[model samples]
Target: MKKTLIAYFTRTGITKKLAENTAKQTGADLFAIEPVKEYSSSYLICVGQAKLENLQNARPAMKAKPQNLQDYDTIVVMFPIWWFTCPNIILT
Candidate 1:
């Protein structure tokens, strides 16, 4: 099996659990994609923030990144659906 990395972003822990299961099944390293400035924990506030960020085309800074991306032959990216697309941190 090729070396694999499972990177994921989670707002409500849903994606996080899925990523963990995938990582375990595939024997891949796990990496959490976090924002430098975390969004609100409240669902309503988070939704509002996402909308504003989307309108502005904002790419929030990521708190962590893979140190040796070249070492992994396969990379799996996972995230929650936000505004019918991905959150801006994944684009960064």
Candidate 2:
């Protein structure tokens, strides 16, 4: 059987919940894509930061990446939409 991985990035925990539930139902390994520098908890500040990053086409540093990522035959990425797309941190 092919191994499956569920990788996700979440700001408000909503995407995390969905990722966890999906992983549970699909029997997939879960990986959280975290940034090296955490974003502000303030929604407005975070949105502003996201907007700036998007405008600059920035790729923020990540805390870690899944080990043996190539071993998984299927990888599902989950994240909340930021400026009409995935967050910049996910690009790291």
Candidate 3:
């Protein structure tokens, strides 16, 4: 079987659960891309922050990263769609 890595960034746990389930079914390594500084839990605050981050083209620091990326033959990235695009943290 080809080695696979499932990397994802989640803000409200929805994408996280989907990534987890996909990883389980595909037998792939799972990695969650977390930011060094978390955004506010409030939906409105998060939306505001997203807008600010987009305006600034901010690439927030990721708390964790996958190891041995070269080992994976296939990679799957998952994240929630914000403003019709992936979150800034995912771009980091």
Candidate 4:
């Protein structure tokens, strides 16, 4: 049989919930993209890093990008508008 996978990265969990529901509905395999350096739960850190005037907004690094990208024909990307753009890591 053909295969389908739901691949996503969610920091605040809103997209995670949506991915779960979509996977259940479609009977697709689910994959969560997580950074090696997880962010702190404190809202202050989020706002601080997301600061528009500060260059710190773009310096945070992800441990690695998901491998096996060629395995899936379809991929779902989720973002939360970090600096009016998708998370910097997604571009990697």
**Which residue pairs show collisions in model 3?**
none
Clashing pairs in 4: none
TM-score of each: 0.94, 0.94, 0.95, 0.69
lDDT of each: 0.90, 0.91, 0.92, 0.68
Per-residue accuracy of model 3 over 2-61 as CA lDDT, tens digit each: 899999988889999999999999899899999998988999999999899999999999
Between 2 and 4, whose lDDT is larger?
2
3 or 4, greater by TM-score = 3
Model 2, residue 19: displacement in angstroms?
A: 0.6
TM-score of 1: 0.94
* Cα lDDT of model 1 by residue, 1-92, tens digit: 57999999998899999999998887999999999999899999998888888889899988877899989899989998786889988888
lDDT, candidate 1, at 37: 90
Q: Is candidate 3 or candidate 4 better by lDDT?
A: 3
Q: By lDDT, who's the top model here?
A: 3
Off by over 4 Å in 3: none
